[model samples]
Target: MANRWLRPEVYPLFAAVGAAIGICGFQLVRNICINPEVRVSKEGRAAGVLENYAEGEKYAEHGLRKYLRNKTPEIMPSINSFFADPNRS
Candidate 1:
């Protein structure tokens, strides 16, 4: 029967493939709708990146990245700094 072909062992493989396709689809949609370069260029594609690095930085930043930009790099600041000093002296 057709159900025989749907083994539990293959379920993870199917999920992985589906997730990859979904991520690709999301990026495609985001770039098409939200990326400034896609809309700004007169022709179909930009010949090169923007001449100004700051301008490109301004355009490329997403909401989550922007929000996290100012936060501390450490996940657990106190714990990390404590262990960071390897010297026991």
Candidate 2:
């Protein structure tokens, strides 16, 4: 009985049928059942953004540290004070 189903000519038809069923199942899940919004969360989105910003800031700080390593340290507190003053147009 099983040998009758395993014949070479019948095998291709069986494979094709299996493939069609798999595709139908996938399409049903994709188009009819699954909700897109449920796959994403606000916390996940915020974490992604925060990680990206942190990576960018880390690279910027590393580059600054490398460049400043050989440069003389100067009094830059006036720069800070100027920005802090805010009243300066």
Candidate 3:
């Protein structure tokens, strides 16, 4: 008697189902491992703004020092005014 459990037609179906499950599992693992942290809180936004402001301050200071040393008339007025009163605008 032929073994019904070892049917040749069912092997392809089993292989296809196993392959799909493996693909889904791989995608799930990849998403969990590679996703970045997201910051959505008000405090996180404020911290980002403060960080940007600090970086801008450093850049402005460097530019002003360079301008002073070179005495570039084109950049002098704006940089000098900004340093003289940073809160003006």
- Using TM-score as the measure, which candidate wins? 1
Model 3 Cα lDDT, one tens digit per residue, 22-86: 99998677445432222356675466534455645554566548767866566578778887886
TM-score of 3: 0.36
- Which pairs of residues collide in candidate 1? none
Q: After superposition, how far is residue 80 of candidate 3 from its true place, in Å?
A: 68
Clashing pairs in 2: none
Specify the poorest-scoring 10-residue window by lDDT in model 1. Answer: 41-50
In candidate 3, where is summed lDDT lowest over 10 consecutive residues?
A: 30-39
Residue 42 in candidate 3 has what lDDT?
61
**Which lDDT tens digits does candidate 1 get at residues 1-89?**
86886999889999999999999999999877766566555563646654556645765886789999999998898788788878743
lDDT (Cα, 0-100) at 64 in candidate 2: 52
Error of 2 at 14 (Å): 1.0
Give candidate 3 regions above 4 Å deviation: 1-3, 37-89
> What order do candidates take by lDDT, descending?
1, 2, 3
Index of the highest-lDDT prediction: 1
